[model samples]
Target: MERLKLDVLGLCETRWSGEGHFASGDKLVISSGSPDGGYGGVAVVLSAAVKNSLLSYTPVSNRLLVVRIQATHVPITIIQVYAPTSSCAAEEIDDFYEKLQAVIDAMKSRQVCVVMGDFNAKLGLGRDFESGVGDYGLGQRNERGDMLAEFCRINGLVVCNTAFQHNLRSRYTWISPDGHTRNQIDYVMISKSWFSSVLDSRARPAAECDTDHHLVTMKLRTKHFRRVRCKSMAVRPFDVTRLRNPDVSEKYSVATENRFSLLQDRYNEECTPDELWDQIQAGITEVAEEVVGRRVRKKPPKPWISEEVIALAERKRIARCTGKDQEYNDLKLEVRRRIRCDRRK
Candidate 1:
């Protein structure tokens, strides 16, 4: 996560039982899965920065989940899904689409929706549905791919990956172990209304996660807006520690008394408990701000990355670039092993 610099990451086939929030260092992970046993699961891992703007999260099913984040101009709804494979029964595939459509329909009309994850559908290169797909897609269309394309057409969504042109290496998101097969099964899709907001989308095959699927990401030219209620002025905390000084204590006491006297003269007995508390709180905050000034918060420290791992990663990259395949493979294994060891600790 630290290496990727991702603000929000959608994970498919998490295979974790039950549903709940878990903490990994400073990151927060919210996942939903099957109750019967580990099988299919979906999750969204948020960085501390994006976590603050999170509005709500819903676990639609073991295969799907939605997270709403308050953005600048509009709310952004992200739907993460792990669709059933093509080998699955037709009925099961139909059920998945039904539930997915319901989730999309439930979203607010004004919200910008992004649906992404492992669709297990290979949307091939075709211009038959020009409005739903671009000419840059990979491979040939199959039954599942047709269904996915149809779903996009009905919902007025554009497959972001296909919308942008890229080389073959950057187009395919999944690769078979035999290295003979490559397909663009995973995707990131956004509502047609905000299609222009997507700057680019591609697969990062060189990313050294142990998964066979490459990390697919879409860059959006948008910003998150602060919510209305969140825009209200926050009362600065009083510096109570200053009260320990005799001179400061006397001054604060005098200020409090003067403010209270003015409040009493203005409201008398008609002021409710709530009103009185508010006035007092405001008075203290004012006095503190005037006397000691508002507190300055320090930025949180970045996640630590060891120098040894950094050096190993650099060497691995160099080896790959120099065509030292054997050395690159060895260093890649070492990097993964070290990462696992560090994560365990």
Candidate 2:
């Protein structure tokens, strides 16, 4: 996650035992898997910043998971899926799409929706279908690919990966273990109406992970709105650290004592314990604000992306541009290996 600087990562074939959330360091992993077995699963891993805005999440099934987050301007719904493989039964494939469609149907029309994962459907070069697919797709269209394209067309979704132009090698998201076969089965899709908001989408072959599939990402140009709240409910931290100075501490103590004395005169002797406590709290807060002042909140530090990774990424770019296939492959593999090791740490 730190290597790629990803905010949210969709995972397929997670093979987790069941549907639930798990903590991995600072990030959170929300997954949905088969209740009867652990053969299939889907998950969405959220960065701390993004997780803070999470409104809710739903475990659709072993093959799907939906997450809703409260953005600054609107709510965004993200759906992670693990579709049936080509070898799977037709009935099972149909069932998977049916469940997926149902989830889409339930979504609010105004909310931004991002559906991404390993579809296991090779959406070959999207040549003829200009509306739902782009011309940059890899390989020839298969039956499963047809189903995926049709699904997108029906739902007014656009295939993000095909829309962008990248190197043929960069377009393929999966490779055979023998290194003889490659295909673009995994994808990221968004509502057709918001196509302009989609900056780019591509496959990161150099991404290191345990899975055989490469990481696919989509960048959107949308902005988040700040959460609304009552002003009276706003709470600021007092700069108690100022009390480290003897002079400041003495002054604060004197001010608090004076305020408490005044509050005691205002409250009746018959006041309940709760009322007295409230008065005391108010007095202390007033003195603290006037004496110590409130502490300012700072944005959390961004995840570190090291210079080594940056240099390697730049080298990869240059190698691609210069048509250094062997060098590019070597660097890509190194980058992926480093990423895998970093993530494990």
Please, what are the lDDT tens digits per residue for candidate 2 over residues 205-266? Answer: 76745356888988888655434556765876788899999999999999988898898788
Q: Model 2, clash count?
A: 4
- How many pairs of residues collide in model 1? 4
What does candidate 1's lDDT look like per residue over 1-345, in tens digits?
567667889999889888878666577789989996478999999887777678888988899898999888888999999999877899999999999999998877888999999999988986655448887889998889989989998889999988888898889999798768999999999998898888898888777455679989898988765445533456555567777899988887788788888877888787899988898889877877776666565455444556798789888877865878799889989988888887676
RMSD of 1: 5.8
lDDT of 1: 0.84
Highest lDDT model number: 1
lDDT (CA) for every model shown?
A: 0.84, 0.83
- Give the C-alpha miss distance for residue 55 in model 2, angstroms: 0.9
